[model samples]
Target: MANVEFETLAALLEREGALPSDRALALLREATRTLSDVHAAAILHCDLSPATLLLSSDGRVLLAESALARRLGEARQPDTPATERIAAPLYYPPEAAQGLPLDARTDLFLLGATFYHAMTGAPPFDGEDPETRALQYIRHEVPPLEQRVPGTPVLLNVLMQKLLRRDPAERYQSAAELLEAVERTERMLQKRQEARRAPAAAGAAATDTPRHGKRPRARQSTAPAEAPAERPPTTRRAPAKAPLWQSKPLLYGGAAAALALATLIALLSRGGDSKPQATKPPEAPSTASAVAPANTPTATARKETPRPVVEPPKPKPKPKTSTAAPPREEDTPPKPQDPPEVTPRRWKAVQGAAAGTETYEEFLKRTKGIEVVDYEDYVVNWEYAGPYRDPACAEKCGPFDNEFPPEKPGEKPDWAPLPKGADAGRPWLFNFRNITQIAQVAADRAAIYLRTRVYSAIERDVQIWAGSDDSIKIWLNGQIVHSNRRDRAVRPDEDRKDVKLRQGWNDLMVKIGQGNGEWGFCLRFRTRDGEKVEELRADPAGK
Candidate 1:
């Protein structure tokens, strides 16, 4: 492999201060599209920060550092201690800080924070200590982008807010969706840049004419005699409609234009036989005579509008009439249309769908199979028991590894299944909710046992994904396959374990111990490659 060097976006920002809106937008679009690709492959860029964005000497923007990337729907490993998985607080999501299970949306939050830093040259939630920063993100809303940097585009500001939403459900559900939003904001940013440039360009061109030493009268004298009036009629009519109550200048200005047009036409008719002399000084007809030339029969024919009659003399006007009334008429009509030249309508903020509550089933349907684990697609039945409790056990300390059919109430000596509800006066229960709430077992600091007989067509290695409140332990065909003794809220697919299933029927059992609040567990199976297990059947009765 070649050692190619590149500058981190963080360093680039440090050297350049803050990026221009257009530059920031281009970089954001590229980074978002790259993230969309990563998500397409069922991967999550858990660590998205300015430091992870690289700018090549060739000017291409890239997302680098895949070390923190994890498979879609995967969560922090239970076997790994919490201390080893500490994330940089600046870029990690609120869910990560709270120890909740993560998915593709988690990365979207980080991406938003990273870009916030890119635009303002500082993290949205900044602190010297990781704990303080994490607390800030978890408990507080990020200040608006405009508040941090005045005059930031509103569309971009709103986008940053949506991406950094405290609730994952409020954020864009997929990278593709977020990419669409970014492209829209980028286009608006481009329109604003072009709008600002248009007026400056027009002003610059106007200034250049003065430097060329050509008076306004010289420009009028040089115009072709038969030149067409390309000016639109609306441009001329717009000024006449303005009321004097709006401004005294507008009323006086309209009257002055009418007088200028009348004076210009009369001069051309009387001066038809006279030749222009640059050395002659103006007397009573100073404004008109200064501009009239050696006029021809063409000048005498059309006297209605001053434009046609005055244009016939292509080269005689001099600097003496440069500030005359005729030049003022040409400038009046354009004032109405000037505002439209720098149109800011294209920079209007784009509105997005408002956030609302959504069911898990609705989410699955809307997102299709991407990023989320659809437990209902793979497994539909689970036989469960208990709200079993052992006086010797505390919160996460339970009879997870003890022998089945405990000698006493909630008692277990070693690794085995506990007594089924049928033997404990609670009888067995069943549900197909994907996530069995185990609400029937209402007691806190209790345990629930879930079992199902899974039939596979052939012997193969497969994966079982499970989640539970408080703590959970799983057994595959009487062998302990996975166990996580941590107190936390449940999320689907929090733990994935690979196990061998026999050619026929196999017993799958689960022990979930609850501490407080919600009590539930969800389980599903798939091929080792994370595909649906098409030839599997679930029987709560072990048929």
Candidate 2:
């Protein structure tokens, strides 16, 4: 009921890190939907401040004293006690309410208001007091969403503006529509987050390796060259540095070479001592024995083993340095997925007047041929002459008094009887049946005419029923009126309402045709105010 209470709700949400409870949120959602669907004319919450909402154990719901609930014509007192109050009333501008019927769109505005308050710490239309806020809701324009929350999606902002439109028709037609827009905003936000993180992850990977690479290289380059020889003794003393053995490829290679040399020396000593002492000839043996002593078996073995050890050390160190390159390659992050292109689709006008197709290409072709009228809200209006010319059919074929009786049984008229003193004669009737003609204009712009004359000084009303696959426009007495192009059937009886009539002779013209489906027109008129004058009738024979 007060701003203080609204502040309290905010405090609670901040502390909890979420709305009061799922049940409360669900109740609010359902209530919002109900209000939008049934009372499209009413604004659910005239004052959308935090205090109007009550968060109970069950969840969050509107308080009875909330301006919206009161405006909705609820009978409950503001102070009435309840476990939960789910609905609020809304106030509508009298003119807008009278002109257009309320529908679900009205409630969507409230929902948006609710979301705005929840996300921002303030109401969308903040004011000094409840009365001021109500006035702002009625007259003052709410600030753009960016002003409230920076980086809001344009689509979301536009949707909120539409929901809060003064005219109900301009708002979303139902709660479902508003929900869809909300869901889309959520998806867009998710995609944006993904897009932002992709580049960040790649950059992080790029920076990581250089930081890690510098440390190891610095330690290795600063270490003493004699560090290798000291490593084996250090490993024997402390096993903790045993892992360092794998790192000392050069030291390991030297140790392997020393062990191989010792083995080769032992093998040669056994071979020489056991072999030729007895088999040598006197002069040959003397030289061979002297050579063997000079070149001892141990020394010969050491030379051969050292040669192989030197080669192994060289290749072993090369492979270790080569192995380091793969880690650097591994450290390089995989390429980031490219962000999807976000191309916004905007509404554009396709055709101009002059009986041309409204397709995008057709609209382009007629650029130089017709006048294009631009209306508010990006609506385009065009006019073109129809395709059909007057037909040369015989005029004087039917008698004026000829009445074809009803075809079925029990399909009687449902009209109120004439008042006591009223003088009522037979009603004048005209029927145009079984006619096929095509206008020169494209099918979307065809016009059919039913010409007739009326003789009366009194008030008269006429109704025209027409069906077309594409579109239809009806006019009486030169006034451009009654147009239907929606993707629904056009019923003559239900669609045509009462119209004023003029005295003396008059022409009733109806232009109807299939834009895409079967095309036909039907009309009926009755004199409500004046006496019918027989002399005023135009004779078809004379014409």
Candidate 3:
């Protein structure tokens, strides 16, 4: 009744030829479960009209008369068991009022009636009035399904007929059994379709090679004849007259001239019998002078034979002493050495005001590195000695104070007491919402000390955001609390459980860049309780 919408089952059946077998069975099962869970005695009355059965948007189940009973009858009269009874205003069968015991099969019969209408896009029993349909449901037999809707499966038709039997005992025993029969029939039909398609696909693949064979053979036959026809004309025009350099006779003549010159040189080299003039017996033919006959087959053998022995000249050593000295060894350079390491000084300063007669106004103007030394468990004393390491704080020096009120009315305020041995120096404090900047924070054993007050009571939980390029440690009171030595972003939100605050004043001390940034740090706090707090501005006047 709360903006409920209805869609007729007849429209769905007409659009999608028949309900898928699985979907139909699933609908029936879900309907049974819903009825069981609601403790409905039975879905006693049956309405078989095309418009009465409505399929829900999920397409899983039909919203039968139970939803109507709950909306119209039960909602109006909460105490009455209207959903259990078949009353006039809620639902119509007067016979159902006679107390016929209903069970799961009664609901299955109604589902069968819905299925019949869905398959045919029309009710099993055709009647304009509800009374007529009710009478038919009780007495008349459903018409043969195939006669009304041709091509309906024989199994489905028989199932519908069984469901419409006048006697409840003659119908399918339960919805589950009816659903099983429909599923078996659907599977058989699907298997048959797949069997028919398989052979068709194989035949298509078998015909593919023959279909492409003709083109390749036709190209091969025409290619050879075309190549010969294009080649003859190019060959005929190639030779006009050969160049002299390429003539065969000229080449042979040049080779003969070269051979004759070589023979003449060999004769001249064997100087004509010169031994007669000297009158000495002709020396035996020297081994170097032996020559082989041109036609001898032993000429190659002569060239390969070993000649008489000859010794090579040996290299002589120089005299032992020399005037010049040997070149001195080249001078070698020395290896470079590594640079020395610089160890950083830790935070040793205390937190609070310096000891002097200087006014609070003058103390605020001085920019110096202040040390916060923790003496007791809960107290941190601070002192400012001189300017910060930064060039901006050159010669400034004054007394620093964080105490609440002045000692006398309208008189200069007293400086907060410092822990013993805390030297006065420039104090570093950074403030921003979401932006980032750099500041030099120096201290001894303790980290850098930050002195600030929360203006308004933060009604909601908040986070203090802090980060540094080097090592950093944060303290709320004098206690050394959160530390991030890994040089990563610091989020107090992650440690929100550890942070505690009163309504008025809150102090934060952070030591960062221990040896690096002169212990530099940058931090801010933000609320995380889903509400933004109006933060107090930095008030030098209040101090």
| C-alpha local distance difference test of each model | 0.67, 0.43, 0.44
Please write out the lDDT profile of model 2 over residues 348-453, one tens digit for every residue: 3221212443544444343322111211111011111233322332111111111111112463322221111111231121111112123223332233333334
Which candidate do you rate higher for TM-score, 2 or 3?
3
lDDT of 1 by residue, 1-543 (tens): 155568898898888888876688778878888889989999877778777888776666778866767788764576452422335557658888877888889888888888888888888876545755775677567889999889888888899889999999999999899999999888777798787878677887888776757677798898866665755657656455556567888778988999877776565445634435422444435634444443444445545455665576578667867855575654667764343343232111100121456443453354332221223443445555555666665444344544444223565433323222221221221221223344443545567676667877689998988766658888888788999987665566889999999998888778877654445556778779987665566665555
The TM-scores, one per candidate, come to: 0.36, 0.26, 0.28
> Deviation in angstroms for 250 in model 2?
85
lDDT of 2 at 239: 48
Q: Taking the tens digit of each residue's C-alpha lDDT, what string does model 3 give over 229-306?
A: 778786777677889998989999988999766644443344334433222224323421433233244534433342
The candidate with the higher lDDT, 1 or 2, is: 1
When 2 and 3 are scored with lDDT, the better candidate is: 3
Clash tally, candidates in order:
5, 27, 32
